[model samples]
Target: MLTGGPLDVLTGDYLAELTMLILGRDRLRNPDLGYAKTFLRQLEEGLGLAHERGVRIVANAGGLNPAGLADAVRALADKVGVPVRVAHVEGDDLMRLGAAEVPEVPEGPGEGLPAGASGEALAGAWAGALTANAYLGGAGITACLRAGADVVVTGRVTDAALVSGPAAWWFGWGPEEYDRLAGAVVAGHVLECGTQATGGNYAFFTAHDVRRPGFPLAEVWEDGSAVVTKHPGTGGVVSPGTVTAQLLYETQGARYLGPDVTARLDTVRLTPDGEDRVRISGTVGEPPPDTLKVGVTRVGGWRNEVVFVLTGLDVEAKAELVREQLADALAGAAGVSWTLARTDHADADTQETASALLRLVVRDPSPDRVGRELTGAAVELALASYPGFHVTAPPGPAQPYGVFTSALVPAASVPHTAVLPDGTRLRVGGGAGPGTAAPHDPRLPAGHGTASGADPLPGPGVEPAVPVAGGGGVGGSPAGPPRHDPTTRAPLGLLAGARSGDKGGDANIGVWVEGDAAWEWLRDTLTVEFLRRLLPETAPLAVTRHELPRLRALNFTVAGILGDGVASGHRFDPQAKALGEWLRARHVDIPTRLLPPTPEGNHP
Candidate 1:
């Protein structure tokens, strides 16, 4: 914002599900420490300039304490000798209302199943309850903005609300404006992660200058259509590919649901307005769910882990020895687990080779058991353990783990409200009506088949199949002879760009091609069977694929890869942030025709 020139409003999104738990812990330690400290630090430096320029600020840095954050901002304004009107949106802290009062909602593929539920494997995860804050909407923020406040601090509002609130007030849109609100939501989703829309964490890294990519900005017009762009002379490229990648990032399914509106992503359209700007239009929105989603955090049990590395020959044997020793030492230890991962090779090479990791983790209801008993059992074998066995590091004191469960509360139960500078409280109503869960199928393109959520299947398309030489075309394509040049085994990135992220226990991988020629190959080549071949880890799990021809992208939903959400997941890529890059690295048979004739290896 410092270099991006004057702006009508500025929003900072600082809350995530994990962040809420962390902040709750902090609040437990010190009442005044719940709000994000970084936000205040940034405000101290920029508040004066922002106030001077009439740039309003809205942020969810108010974590578990919006009132406290508002007080700090007011104090800062006094210290800086500026008369600023600061207001905060509150009433999202559902713990104050009691847990039993809030009804639990059914968790879908996006939100992981609630602990102890039939489908959820990890029951009794949230035995010890902590803080539960409902994800809020923009009504309060918009009210604060309309009330002449210079800054609005909110607690746990949906990230998209920060942008939509200002846009709603600026456009004077009513509560029933679904399409326009959905369009604004698309803009907000792109800009919520700052530089993400400007090519940060993109699969095709070499295509853009990401060294110091500029932040994204949405120029929303009167009609709700927005042109996503970055400041001129920015480090990154803001093309259709980058914007679409950000759109698909971290989304649970095609329908982007928030407290304000449920956007139909498949219906949204993107077009190039000019250089470094993409026009977002044709977005349809539905009424938000009647119930508000709240993240419930509880003390999941105490846990400790130790990693032992086995080097050189007999790597597997060494791991087995360690496991055997641990099993003997902790014979009666309950909830103790060990995983032997082979990161070794047979051939002689550097020390990094022929090294395997034996990871041991133990959890118990009693913190003392995990802190002392678990650690002692592992250390007892240190002297008489397998040869070349070395611990990665000392196991620190057992730490408390948090289990996250998402539930829905009636909109009226929370009494959503906004507090003004003069102590005036304004009631903020939730959006129009009850929301409907949209059907999403990742196994096939929209027009090709059935979704898991009982969506009606579309009639089959009658496009002619292209002939290829190999009897087996990738993704089970029928073939006779070569239609293009000979095929070569290469990474899928040779022809496409990808973006991926996690939603609870599931991971969504969105792969897209630039032009019609590449897209034709991508849609046919990267089918569910082919994706399973590329990433064998997803082979055992149920995989769903969805095709968006308008964006020239195919989205695949990998189920249960992350055991749970980021908090207790055992996978190395817990959130599956790197799943896309890993898929791009997997080698595949690429038709030689897809390769560029140029030296730079750019797609034709």
Candidate 2:
């Protein structure tokens, strides 16, 4: 909701990415006006909230223009008469980094997943770095607190680092205690991406007033564990269950990794303590592998999203005819490219003069060449089919298009920070690394696996594991109707967004599915009722119904707690993929059954 990019903001479908040549992996704060507006609004509100609560502050709301944004805030401080000394942590803004000085993408050969190897080369080194902000560690923030900054405005600091920095300043912690700092860092990570997971982009919210989902308020303890809450009377729920649900959003099996540590995220407990309150605790943390993390994307080549409003013709016959003509027109195309998918496909076979959209993807290293070849495709459509020119192919040749490449940058290359700007001196309380564990020598590194979203399996006899070893169920359920809807509400803008890559701290769940079939319609409308009934019946396992596109299929992840090994992430493994193959190979007795909807008639 606060940032750009569909995938970056909301969770849904992202079919594929065209390969991008990496120019460089540099991080910098965006100076875009829109981002700054979002930052300023949140920082002011978060500060107001903290001020009311008698909490001190230093912040990084400077998104794109650290100094410029800071200057405006400084004017505000002058009005409030709060003498705040600000520190601006700099040097990682890649827009300033030279290409010759461009660092190499980290990742030794064969260290990452099959798709994980698309290093920064795809970005085109000649272009160099645009932004290089990392989720910062605790070191720099400590300086800001000591310098006595009334408020800190920095560009591209880690979200969790904002909170953890204060903690370090409050307690004077050293890097040798990085694990404890990491623990607090993880806590901050959970809430950094904005609203509570329960309401923002999270699927479990009962009545999210997205219109006004208040920004989360985290209360960190000495152990590095924190409780996530939100402003009173705001839209959205704050409970252990909701937080736990969020924790499971992106994890692969039972693994949770930090730059210096990987937590075996067990001991997750959610319980209702009172109205709109839940406590989430994760005390057990693992050490991170000494390997750099990176993001990799590949361009499978070019594809034109040609949408057409088809009408007036033997729909199927005309479509086939058009496809043939276009294919023929692209006869010498490096790779023959053609598809005949029509909207309301059910009507494609019998309808005459129906509306439709056609998409064609051309694959080649030379985007210009591919774009050139498409010209004939347009003419064939107009000339080959009945009145085709009057409709889809009207008097023009398809134009050339540029395709983007894919690439990655190492974690070391991503800069993080804490700051004490020029005129403020405010002490940032709290300490870093109160609970971080040491690295295990045999650790597997981050970025070695695929992006999450695999379908889930059925688990057997599962329970919510808590990090504290024993559980005191810290959250509660609504005894009455929910007070607000997090989805429909406006942003309280309590906190500005944290640095780039800071989105990695929250806990996630990984579901598994085997293959792609009837994928566009998750589980073929198997229905949530079936999932609900199936869950209780499993007895010893947990059951979660999700639309998992990774498996390219609808999946039911059953955890042992829900009585099956599905959502629990136990029993499933790399070897189990063979089991998926076995299932695919066998005949399935699937029913074309209707699925039950929620009482409101919305499909779950």
Best by lDDT: 1
User: Per model, how many backbone clashes are there?
Assistant: 6, 154
TM-score attained by model 2? 0.54
Query: Which digits, one per residue and each the tens of the lDDT, describe model 2 over residues 22-42?
Result: 211111222333124454555
Show pairs that collide, candidate 1: 442-544, 442-545, 442-546, 443-544, 443-545, 468-481
C-alpha RMSD for every candidate:
6.1, 14.2
Please provide TM-scores, in order, for all candidate models, with all chains considered together.
Answer: 0.86, 0.54
Model 1 steric clash total = 6
Worst 10 residues of 1 by lDDT: 459-468
Q: Supply the global lDDT for candidate 2.
A: 0.40
Local distance difference test, candidate 1: 0.74
Query: Could you give candidate 1's per-residue lDDT for residues 346-442 as a string of tens digits?
Result: 7748777768788887777677877877778777777898887678898778877766666655565566789987879998886535444333434
